[model samples]
Target chain A: MVAALRERVRLACSWCENAIGFIQESRLPNGARRVGAGTMAFRMFIIGLVLVGSLAAAPAAWAYSESDPSANPDIDPSDCESCHTGTPEIAGTEEARQGPHANYSATSRSCYACHQVHQAYADGYLLMPGATTTETCELCHDGTGGKGVYGALEARGLAVASQHRTEVTTQIPGGDEATGGMATAALSGYQGTLSCGDCHSPHGGGTVEPFTTDRSRIETDVAGFFSNQLLRRAPTGATYEIGVYGSDWCAACHSGRASGVHDLINHPVDTSATVGPTAFTYESVQVVDGVDSPQTVQGSLGRSNFGYVMPWPRTAGQGTHAPVCQQCHEDGRSVGDVASGRIKASEVFTVTSADGGTAGDNPRFQNFPHESYVENLLIESYDDLCSNCHHPNQLP
Target chain B: MTPDAAVTPVNSRMRIRRSMQILSAVLLVVLLVLLVLLFRELLTGAPEYPVSQEGIRPLHVILGPGVGNRPFFDGPMGVTFGADGRIYVADSGNHRVVVFDSEGEYLFQFGGLGVGKPAAGIEPSWKPGLFNYPTDICSDDVGNIYVADFRNDQIQVFDADGDFLRVFPDRNEPLGRGASGQDGAGIAVTSLTVHGERVYATDTYQVAVFSTEGELLDQFGRPGAEPGDLDHPNGIAVGAPSVVVVSNSNRNQVLAFAPGGRFMWSFGKPLGNDLAGLSGELELPRGLTIMDDGTVLVADALADSIVRLTLAGEFDGRFGTRGAAPGQFNAPMDVDEADNRLAIAEKGNDRVQVIVIED
Candidate 1:
């Protein structure tokens, strides 16, 4: 075995040296003479050496002993670890030591938690035993799956109102056309696509990184650098400090606004904005009926008196909050007084924030209102986008 | 002697050089063969047919412009094979039911506009037999036809010969509102099936049981994702020994219940695309029928095909694709089997096609 390993290493080194020499010789000096016969001969020799080396190493690289317990199964369990972490052969032990699940000593941070060994229920990357990728995530993130960090978000019932609802059924368009049917397109730049795996990697590698716009660019590095909270992209590792508007992750697709093209026309979403007093307070208003007495009804959020914070930026002035795209565009479902039509509202929400956490602890923000009769997935009326921070009656 | 020795040495060198050349040639040939094999494995390409059904083919199709100036179907939603060797179709958009013999001959037609009684406070323009959107049809042993009047919120019964018998729940009773508060009527009967003396119907959320005489016997279901709960239950079928199957379309699962409405077991998962059994999933399942061997055949509207599954909800196989051809379908809504032949109602294409399921 030692002799074979030494021979393989020697062959690899020889192949690399020959390839480099061939490249160096091919480059003629600036303003020098035409290509020479010696250069052609050297190129041929390098090609022959590479072919010979590859032929000799091919069988040794693919060899597997029949008697080995982990050798050559129908579904090679070890193949996943070649690129991903959380497997015995890769960084499973190290991830278990440092990952969020490390404190939960009882939890097994293996790939099996979110993936199946064979015959996956979903199409790509073989999601867990659940039928959908969202369901597999909900098994752990729905408060009952033994994970506590996400339990509060699940308890708020935001799945139906959030823009990133995992239950979206619209088929994503634009993929390999030769397959004869619609293929699953990548999450970035594709509208109406939602799944748990779209934003988070269950293997603990992190989320999808920003790639070039060119479709032909083949990314060799499957696992990019990590970010806090497993975010897809952030300016720095300390993502919580930077508000939702500051992060460039969503800009990968919604380039018009996130890329500052709509900066002047759009409402100010920066962290510097703060909610004024008398914004979210409640009151009853009376209206006269045709018959006799007046009828009283609870006023809308636009007419409220107490100030409330928008729920996107992690930190804002006291009594104020920031907003993200999710605050308005929820799962392509109807919201807030929208007329019922052929399309139906989703029954799940994807974003919610708990109160009493430290500043910049949750990027989703706090005190998100649940679904109401609002149109376009808004948590409140269009007037309330300003009234939630600025008093309607006091507006100029 | 010295000169001979030098020549011998040169001859040996020539032999060695020739041997090296042959070895290089052999290696090049082996490498080329390996490259060819690798390329073949990597680019095997897609299958010739989208769906794999060995010998199935369409035997005939029922097109428009029938005899005696009768109107053809604008959009056909449901189809059923009666015991008397006749095919009944709920010609939904035309507001009628068209009947045809087994040989693709148009036998007769009935239940056109102005054929039924209107409800109180409702205009006389719409009635029970006069369907706004007749979604499903079924038949029993005695050839009694049951038509699900979807918009009318009633089930209109007719004789095998296309004669209107009666309407269930009566026109006088106010239709109860649905869970979504959309239906002002009592129940929105989407699909139904008959077993012995009982009639089972799905009201988009619950399965209501009724006697043959149009009396409500019992009902069980609610809007939920849990067991015994239903979400847009569109299709219903009764299998051997009284097992009731309901296709929960939105949830993308099929729920089974015993004779007394006890939740038995549910199978299928929420898959946006069309697929077959356990590993395969369902999308917008609309109509289903139980075959003689207890296997269930479902017409998946979104998939535009017919999916066959075992009684235990295991996938067998499926056929049909989205097209306007004879063997193809454009949003197939329901499927029924008779005499080893299958009848499909194409809602999008406005036609009825019959095909044989070959072994």
Candidate 2:
């Protein structure tokens, strides 16, 4: 298309030259008398004027940088700087929240990344430069766009591959809000697609709390960071409160997996895992190189100190209950790939302490539906995830 | 030269010369036109074109400015423009009324249960200055705010400055439920709007238009799915088409009535089939505002948008989407327009989205 435009411009210029040459081919009434040089030059000038006017009518002929947005200057910061702060203060002094959508971008923070600033066209929600939430995100998230590793479009598109059906165009934000299920739980045909905004807040820029300990804190503490996808409603350790927060955020639609009502998955979630009696916790055996030693222990239902935090759900109170979805179901196809200058980038990530000190590392699971995990596999088998709480016996 | 070649007639030669000149002029004009046409299309069209031609666009959003971060909103139920032109919102979940300037900037708020802090949990309050789930809000002639203090079951009045003025009916239950829905049986004032001399209200199933002095000026409409019959009528507004009420029945429609308590017209039956409502289609229509131009804007919760219609119930346009973005809404419950600025109250998002309506 660009080449065609350039060629068309050349053709218009040639046509203009032809018109000027036409006046030059004039003849006087007497066979041999030629028109005066001055008169002939003036006529050529008139042809030139017509040619310039034609070009003006179609600006694309000469305005080469029209399609490139970069040809324009950056949006002046003073336009929005009077209100939004570049650096926002978070709850903790060191855990600076950095306002919203401020940090994490290596590129210039030219407010132009998402906002059109002046002649914005999207129909609200700060939707500029694009139409839907998906389009706005795709501005930089598509593979060719921002290389957004966890692109919103891919999530909705990969729904048929055992990924959760986010293609449904229905608004079940906190799930069904009643009997839990997809938007099509009752009505069929069209439903609202579970777009990126459904789970993550685009403007969600705040301190990242690794895991939930208190049931109340779950209401706050939305998106973690940029490289790490933003999760607006990270679950709590307590019972899933409908549409509120915690485990219920997921149970809102997956009520079939919730406690009490979930008859299919008989091993109810949010149920006590320490019901039977054990002699000072379950005594187990271990062996030394040369001597046989029986290691005895107190029964701790949901304690994880086995060299790892054990990819599992947050525990309420002292951690004694059936596993929440987060316990086994995690995000990201695999652990984050190792980055340069730091430690291995698998599940573990770099961390900074409240005093601005460097903490060794923190683990995170990201952009899931990893490999065959969504449909055919699990992070770890049920035996490994459950043995931490329930010690079962073989049925006779 | 003419004397040398006399084979052609002089008259014929003159005519031929004129024809050739005209042809050359026509060809030159045609060439110029083609050049301009090609030039326009050869280039990429205008980089930034309008995405929508809707008269209104989102300007700002007011997320519940909580008190010390205790999380203030469970549902910001209703919104309206006070005579002072300030934005008044019914923060029902916290049993309070929060006020903001025309720009939606939080100014001051009054009336609430308990300490009025949502994080501390709610406490029942029937005092004149306090309330219990103040749902619908509106203002009278002199910028005096009237809130339907749900559990308190009274029309609590206040001045523009958020100061307590007085309580209607003075008694605990003088604010009748109206007829059956108004008999003070098992209901509170469901909806409220201000007209010429009276404040029109709804109570589960009935309509109450009262004088600013708390006198019940008139009562009309009933519970049903037919014309003028309001089943589960939760919203009310008076416009050129008379009294318009939104019914939350299985039929899911809006009914209008003449000022004399007679049926006029109705729209939205069994609810519009689509969430994005085409033309007059609607999802869950809630609070409505009558634009000065005689158009109606109704809040459709499930669709997460505002559906606009003509006074005659014809679809005009729609705005908004389902999200927490500036213009997006999460279950918008009510909307009010004043001086081209629209203040939208959202139940799910717990905030009021403000947009400037373009003429």
Candidate 3:
């Protein structure tokens, strides 16, 4: 036995010595290992060299952790606060503190729960397990799996596109072909699965804000008023009294639209009066409505719709600005009346199509205070009224 | 000198005999050592696996899209080794069992998509044979093959050569407790280690264990994100002492369990290497088998590679790259280890690839 062991050791030593000699001979004037560029041939060579050995002998030495508790750390929102301070702190503000993501367990928010790091099994953007498929997010958003709050919309079945295609399977469009529909248009090219972060984000955009015209290239801010949350340093300290400027928040995905943002008026700057009125009337204000909002103008976000009390406040980059969902949905206090106190309201709009015709005089709605009288305006309680206007079945 | 040698003959003879015995013993010991080394190298690849490069001989085989006497069923689900040393393929597409020898020869076939017992007008090629999309297959110590009839949601047992051996428990009884139907799949018999005398299977939705008579013993691994959770557990294997290995494909990882389904450890990743963004690397690492040397081999389908991992969850390197070459595979699904050869059931290409471990 000792003789055999000795012989094995000698052989191994000789092999090692031979390898060392090869390495030495391969070295150039510089001391670094001569790693070639990333090419198929290079990769094949590396793989071949590594595989030229007996695997059954010692098994693999690389780590195999199907049950790696360490792989997924018990995420602490506070840990994220270091770089994500402004938003969460803003969310922590009195107006947005009660949302499920803000109040749930530290890691329970749809953000961390779904966006995992190092998801080798998933597509791009390391999605969490089960989250590998967009259906994973749909499990909660779609009605089929868990009781998804958004799933309630599917029950209405107004041509609701499968979340699968809108988020997972498809790629985000870019450049000239990049129709910013993912954010504003109801339909999507994404075919695999959908995740909450696909539409919303704790970081607003990503490393860089999406629609900022400013070349400074700052992280998308999802704080302050809806119009500026996802755009550049959200207009320092601009405050609104009547309503959020819609065009300022529509550009996140509606880059090609006349307004270059998301709102009823294609160019809010050019058609401001048309979008916002002294007495917010539905028929006049709804010209700004896009293809996604099927609920008509007269009944557009009627009193029954959440938009009645808290309208779908425009996000930053509406015309050339990037606005996050939180800009309009999470902010509980109206920019104009901070002292008026917090009002628990929603921002999802459900505007109907214009007239009976598929495209008859784009849905019109009165903006701000209006002299016109639409019975839909008197419904009261946006929570109840909004469902009528934006209810999934209400789509054109 | 001659006179002295003659006087002490008895002692001299005894000394010579003792020396001979010692020499023989030493030789025997050396021989045993050599044999041990050979077996260890062949199995463990030991100290360092696949001890030598000269010993490895890789082969790739494909099995279904449309060859063989009868093509695969709608779903080509699971494959397992029968006790009689035969490979039983659950040809879910054809709704039958495709039996083959270790050498890749198709011996005979049986069963078909049906709604009756194994013997009632069963046809190997037609529907009505008493089988419905057999998703998975397994074998016991006695050489009995258990087929997981997915659509019908039952386990049908068959003998060595392809004879029906009555379904263990009643077919009507829910095999996987919580997830009793379609999604409730992934079944296996627990060795004495996990439950003393019980059978274990995962509903893919929930985990359940049954007795020899097919009675429910215990259930665990609920579907959730918490520890001891199973998103989509597809395969399982019994390990030394009382460890159970469960493969959760959705999560792209594996879970180890104690005898009573207590959490042990988890490791592994998606099997595929394509980073095209659809999923992880361990792209559906389906089948798992523990060699006698305690090494584990995983057949990662999407990556089109056969991975060798240590019991402790370590990458021991891999064989079979991506391709249809002699040692490459498109989607190598399942594999079994016996003697010194690895019998891999390659699903995409349609034949079993054999790899010999020369270490």
Candidate 4:
């Protein structure tokens, strides 16, 4: 029965492909592509002009959601997506199957369309007409599925508490208020609704990551896992482990210089030699180890969104060097290679999950999934984790 | 050849090539249009550049002269012109009050640095012979200049000729002697503006209306980030009905209060690199003054320029660049309007410049 259910799911996925192909073949009544490349491009160009030009004028335009009801509903998510579904057989239904945003739209009906291509995020873009930063996520996943799980966790007080909408009501200096200039908080807070577009990119890939980009413009030699096979382009061809690079996506909102939200990251104003090296050392896109640099998890990638501070290894004795993430996440210890910073390929990573079992502590435990270590992986990226080895006396 | 190779044609390559040529042509056209628009905006916006006008450089007269450490801000600082056209300065830096003519000549200097004496507390610096940093000196309709002795936490009454009339003791809560977010700070009067029988005095943090005899009729403003909160409030100006403007220096914005202390609105952003080039134009707006036509002039100290804005906080245009030239200012601190003449105190340059502001 389970096999039959899985097969049915796979068949459902194929329905999207059939619809896109059918749309591609069928012409409009006049026999022209309903919205051909030229016309669509022209429309896109005009929209781009309106987006960029209107944004350049000032962010005070009050016409965002006021002009359109189908795209910008005052209440209820279902009503918002009603007019947003373009080609009933294609856009709203089929394209979602092969797309990551599909899961988001499947469960939610009310708020699944009328997406703000941009102008939806405080960090990435400006606010659209009629919608504040808090309304971005209501476009879809109005408390359903993965987003529902996350929201439920937050609502039930499992995750960090969000006073986002309420805290902004009171005016205070450096607090969140959105009124007369007298309210200081209005200028210091973030727009708090994480949307699907905030994390995923369904259009083109390559230079742009899921929701982030390599701002440093660093060049690398190692091929990114997802790009090599599909995009036929290697964005950063540098040998580095996964998970570490994903942290940059989180920093987009957390950084202190964010115009939308209160700067969550402690941005460096003046330099202190005690903190660590600044990002100014390298002029290229590739991350290079400086004379005195932070210990990168994958030898030379990046980790943690701490703007001013970088993590380093907690050294023991005199001249010992710590192993990389791959070496730390492998099997048992083997004394094979001595040179090239390569170990015997046996030293492994230690992961203590929420259930209290070390993932790879025992060589017999081979089928441990990587998700068990996600929380620990985030914690290790901080400087606080290094204190265990830097000051051994404090560690139990 | 293999069937697999034959099954996939090179059609995608040909299609991509055609698309590229179309994309390039479209991009070029778009770029050209953008360039033309930008060029037109640049050329038509300000056709004539700001030029220098001929004449003797206007002199900035520091009206009521007081002495502080080396520059000012000591016993006396505030200076204002009376309706009779006489200049009255707090001279709080020296604990004395001095009066000068419009031509920068001293007419009479009184009030010593110490506490006021019974018969002769009429010179610079009173008992202990030193007044604290008096922030403002303004004359009412009858030529009676009210001096805001900031540090002394009182308003001293003096005749236009520098005669010591009486002292208005600090009725504000005895907070303390220091300034830290406005708390624990004594009642340091910063500015005074009198309208008819009502006198509005903005202490360090509170805006109070007095009835000539120093009786506080009502006071508003607390130290917080709320709408009506005032942080380090200074420089009071009374305009149209119920329009009272106070400079909240700490917030880097001016708060407008209604006649009865009803919070009206606030304008201006804190000075920092964040607001730099907000409009592709640099500004660090401070010291606001309203013209007869409600044209607000802001002396942006850091931006080192004077910006003109509408009453609704719209940046109209800007004048004066960063310099010590004839029309330029080093640090234009305060502005006062009288008839068609505007008096600007250039703090860093230590001069008062008079400008014939054209509409």
Candidate 5:
């Protein structure tokens, strides 16, 4: 019975695909007249095909419940698939099915793995058993589980303890009011608390796994397959890969500097114009046995690589590193202050000297630190930001 | 030898014919299945509306995108009608307050980049008339404009001719200091409403009442989900003489207060599956306004509809549907009642739509 049901579903899916293809092909050219009678007939025919296909897949949906009673016994697993797939199919589920979470392993693929059916612990969406949305993500995102996103965050103290923390109790500097500006309401989407879900979508609809290696190559390979792990994308109508230079996602909430308000007065972001070569770049550091080498390293431009290079376009001739908002600012510093050069150092980067040497090092010459030496999230003073890239001695 | 060769040739021909027949049969079956699927799709038609909006409809939409001679909005958050039947919009994204005539003609604009000058004795760093993100705007009977300069964390007063008047909660005065200290006061003033002699400013947690001259009169309300408590009050309006209404956005309800900061009553249900209803069940209610007839209209952000309620907090009726079409709203952030018309600031669509309310 299972085999037969599988075969039937496969056949139905194939038919549905063909119907969709036919409808797409039947579209009239631009400025053309109304759809012809023949086109209408074809549309009607396609509609009929959808109905029949849904009817055929109905039994297959039921077969999941009939054949596997113990499968996902917490709730009716077929309930979601019934509307999401067989009949009245929701768009993007097919793409979601191809995501890593859905196809990575058998146990992790179920919807119930991340979402609960009733009375969720989180307020808005029914997140799985956890205190908050971030906690729900930490269930599988912890180092031991799979993704290790929380592990990476915790290791860097970005998730907690650091000057910029994602915990609910973290007292954001600005008041929690929708000030029509991004600064005061920076935490709007997070429901008064910054969390992992604010940046990553667990449903795999518009987010990809953070890339750790070979960024440019992986980005080209997954061109239209997924959004960058940061959920960044090129502005609408731009022709670029999924994870290319796009800080508009950050600007969606941080509207002040990122929205071109300080275009003439401050460092440019979300612009195609590249930063001058004087800008700093992220380099890789090689540690020989446990000691760090003094040689400079180069960081990848791909965001998933966690490169120090800002996620903006490089200057054409100068090869300058244009920076995204995240490069110089975090939750602690306001975007306006950062754009105004009031806040120079970023909390994301911290530094510590090795062998009891001076704590500060040219960030461009050293690997990015995991924690800051001072209470503020800065590796050095505001002037050091320029010195890292411009080399202070070179200046007048 | 000739007979054996002929027999082998005939056998080869038969084998080839049988293979061709099998292939033909498979192709025919596939074609039949495709035809069946096409017929089923035709029967299903396009998908039905995700949520029905058959119960309510707007009378008319005005001042929408490309509707008036005024410049289009980048992010319009607040709308109000002046005493002289003119319109004032806190065009937040553009950092200006735009004025339009009663017939939707562009009159003038003020407070753009570098146009602000700080008042004397105020910090030079504070851009006086300039607005960073003006969330809400209100006008008193004498045509005096009150703007909640949200990011600036101060209320700015302007005359009818768009002249800068004075900043509220004066930095030089003790009103700027809260009970804890001067640091915790005067931050995140989201919205404001003007009564007879008072202007109510909604900070994150409490409503700070100020005299028309910018003196802090009294502040009340706290942060919580309980009645009289404001979790995230984003909108404020004056109903009757002493009645004040505030939309607690996070709680998805509107709470009313009488004079002297007494919580009168609260209405509206929490967000749930029921999208259609006459009683006040809101989803992310933001801006609100009170009509002359003591009717309160709240803009439901998620629902894309403006719900009307009586002064007593009873649901009257609602209007609007979710779309980009005229008379429709896409994530409306604020609503104001003026001259038997409703001015709705659509945050998602980046336009202010004025809908005429029919009897």
Candidate 6:
């Protein structure tokens, strides 16, 4: 290991064109041996290379850690707040970026690690010269899997089989972004190209609800407004609001996909769910004979439709709940049997398409955010999804 | 070459000399440009993959994107070592089990075959051998691989060579007493750890124990706000004297239990942000591993460090910092120690860094 370190330091020195050479050997106060005599030692995040004295400690020497701070004092990146203080838009974002998206800190270069702030913006993004927006995200987000792999974020959300083409497009126009739609037109597909930034706020526009532990990223369960939709209210029971901004999140692009049998929007959206333990009423007022009255159909969440602990049918009772667009969709963790698979798309979507059969197989049949095992990104194909609300007990 | 060569020998010689001079001038310009470019490149501060003396991810192996035997991993959640000195990783994102040598070299993989990327175009099948999102993995004394099938609600067993062995505690068929105190099925098994004759698992809210032969050995825990009650439990381990410890991640606490499922005590407290978990404070602590001396090491994801404690709920010390570099960690999801080496499953870096964690 010491030999490898010496070679690496030699390469680093040679590459820098520095005339680094061994002046002599020395030892520190701790009696750790130091080889190679020079003026300075190269110390970094985890690298402790001695120039005048790279402390080639014994084989059992401890690595640099927080508890072992006394080992080396002069070169540790001990204090981040010393330089990280600023407006939330500036270095303050270092704390904001602490979610699953990866808390890039220290010599890893925090914000500048991904962005070349001073200059070298590529394709209008504040990234390094040659790196594209997708490359920056895929450095970790790609299926190879690291922290921010993106999904329901639950058990099933761990591995997304298919996902949005954030890499293929340039214009991430949606919701209220710079190029996103306005009050009337919130559809990215209706006009411009769609990318990841169109919906996700890298600086954490969402947070975990009051009940759950505090988290920064706006994931499936986190209840903060995004993409022209307000959803995922806290405390999963009756009275939990669904889609405060109208349950048409996916409808921004998918209200009507085609005209033939391929029409996407089948199940109703923005309606009160009849089954469940408790359900928040979307519209509390009922116009009875030209006179307004309280909500007519109060609902509750029941045992899950597909027999899983989900938002819709978790606790069963006589309460009426408002079902939103996400009730039948795949989350970061899709509602699937980890031992089996999610959605059973092979059994659900049996129709073979032109390119063969896209039983949740092709990227085209996949949905936004992430892919699903079934067609149209449905949690289950056809009548099975509808059973979560209508004909709850009739589902097999 | 005919009459022209005879007529203009002197003129041809002059023309050749002129051409040579023009070529020399162009060559000199090219050489000067090359030298200037080389000088700039040499003068550049650091190498392109910049890491100032951290020396580029010391002794790390990238578990990667279909780069040969290393199947493209989605998210690797769990890692364990077998008696044979081979390593087993739960490639959760790919819904498969990936095997590697003790040295972190890719060996082979199984599962992940479905209507997905690595298995796309193939007919989808919900075969029991296939997996959904297998979170954590462990190996019994005999090298039988046990996977915490997080979504499937079952523990799928496999042979050392990656064959489909029997599954434990039938799926959704109700374990022993659950957090609900009722016979509830379909518990999400997020993490797991193995002892001599038992396999301990954390199902988000409770700990379910299973025998080597797939029997429900015992089950305990409840969903409540009390210290003994578990809320979002993950990462479990069993000590020598039969102390079962678990990390209640959501509540940021680690609890210990007796062999027969008795609550011993709960340890863990968030000291302060300034402390950085160096004093054994926990922030979102998950993935518990026990040393030979019954020392417990908990990987605190949010703090980007590891908290060392004892089965008796004593705060030892801690190490690690916040970064994606060697000797540093970024959202370290899991940690396992064997053969005096620590294999860290880094959720942020998307790779397992094998480093020696000594005193």
Ranking by lDDT: 5, 1, 6, 2, 3, 4
For A24-134, candidate 4 gives per-residue lDDT tens digits of 654577778776565554544554454345433422221122223455444443333454445322242222121122322434321212233322222222322113333
Per-residue lDDT of A252 in model 4: 27
* Model 4 C-alpha lDDT per residue in residues B77-147, reported as the tens digit of each score: 35567677766655533556666677666576666545332111233234432365455666677888787
Per-candidate local distance difference test: 0.51, 0.49, 0.42, 0.41, 0.52, 0.49
lDDT of 3 at A293: 39
Q: State the lDDT of candidate 6 residue by residue for B37-88, as single tens digits.
A: 4345445522122222232234445455345544455546677877787778
Task: Please give the distance, in angstroms, between residue A282's alpha carbon in candidate 1 and its true position after superposition.
Answer: 18
Return whichever of 3 and 5 wins on DockQ: 3
Interface RMSD against the true structure, candidate 2: 21.5
DockQ of each: 0.03, 0.01, 0.02, 0.01, 0.01, 0.05
Docking class of 1: incorrect
Q: What's the candidate order when arranged by decreasing TM-score? A: 6, 5, 1, 3, 2, 4
Pick by TM-score: 2 or 5, better one: 5
Off by over 4 Å in 4: A1-396, B1-77, B115-130, B171-186, B270-287
Best by DockQ: 6
Model 2 ranges off by over 4 Å: A1-396, B1-55, B66-72, B114-124, B169-187, B241-250, B271-280
Q: Which ten residues in a row have the lowest lDDT in candidate 4 chain A?
A: A213-222
lDDT score for residue A123 of model 3: 23
Q: What is model 6's DockQ versus the real complex?
A: 0.05
Candidate 5 local lDDT, residue B321: 54
